[model samples]
Target: MTIQLKQEIDKVYEEDYLLWLEQTAEQLRQKDIENLDWEHLIDEIEDLGKAQKNAVETYLRQLLKHLLLYQYWTQEKDYCADGWAEEIDNFRNELEILLRSKTLYNYSASILEATYQKARRSAFKKTKLDIFPSECPYTLEQVLDLDYLPE
Candidate 1:
């Protein structure tokens, strides 16, 4: 692509992203490789992968937070156990949807420890309880299983 045309495409990406996306799709479908916004396209594709991984990490952390509450927060167990369990199921379902990709599933497993630490901190902040484990107590399988609830 000429420098002028490339600059115009990049400007469109910044000024009107939806228009740029539509135009980019048309360019790809037409196989007009010469005019394709290669730089922005590559960045967007990479961002898509990262977005999937980030979503899985987020859901896993939420699941861990609720699991800790349900399993260890004795003071409010009678009042909050069922709600926390429900949130766990919801997060599990969301994680399962995002984890359909094997890459994302493995990514979730890899980030488990780090995500759990964040969850533990969040739980402590909410309940002012320091009783939760320092490390993750549940494995990836247990967290993903719909039927599994930590006792």
Candidate 2:
């Protein structure tokens, strides 16, 4: 069921994903570190709830990768770009630390799971009624056939 939901969600936002990657990559090439506002980013992330929030966080991680790469490129004094390699490594480690310590996606998984479960149950109930062809509107089976699997 999760697989089907993931597929549907991907289908719904396919364009957004592509655009986000392109923009992030462009920001990297332009060395637009000043425009990579983390506070606004965090606010945008916070506005999302459940699976959408998780998805956004995953996207943000990709953006962070590009940002770190850009940081490395910009930190080069003579284009030698030596010390920045280590700095990039440290930056990635720091991101990991922040993600772990800050509970960035802590609420997202549970909220999404609960919402998904509710929707799945509602869908399954509707399908079961359709399959049985019962005259009574609310005659649910003791054991559902489980036809409305996620994927």
lDDT for position 137 in model 2? 20
In the order shown, what is each candidate's alpha-carbon RMSD?
1.0, 24.6
TM-score of each: 0.96, 0.20
Off by over 4 Å in 2: 1-25, 49-151
- The clash count for each model shown is 0, 1
Instruction: List, residue by residue over 11-34, the lDDT tens digit for candidate 2.
Output: 534557565546545766899765
Q: Candidate 1 lDDT, tens digit per residue, 38-74? A: 8899999999988888888888989999999999999
Query: Which one wins on TM-score?
Result: 1
User: Which stretches of candidate 1 lie above 4 Å from their native place?
Assistant: none
Model 2 — TM-score against the truth? 0.20
Summing lDDT over every window of 10 consecutive residues in candidate 1, give the lowest-scoring window.
49-58
The lDDT of model 2 is: 0.39
lDDT winner:
1
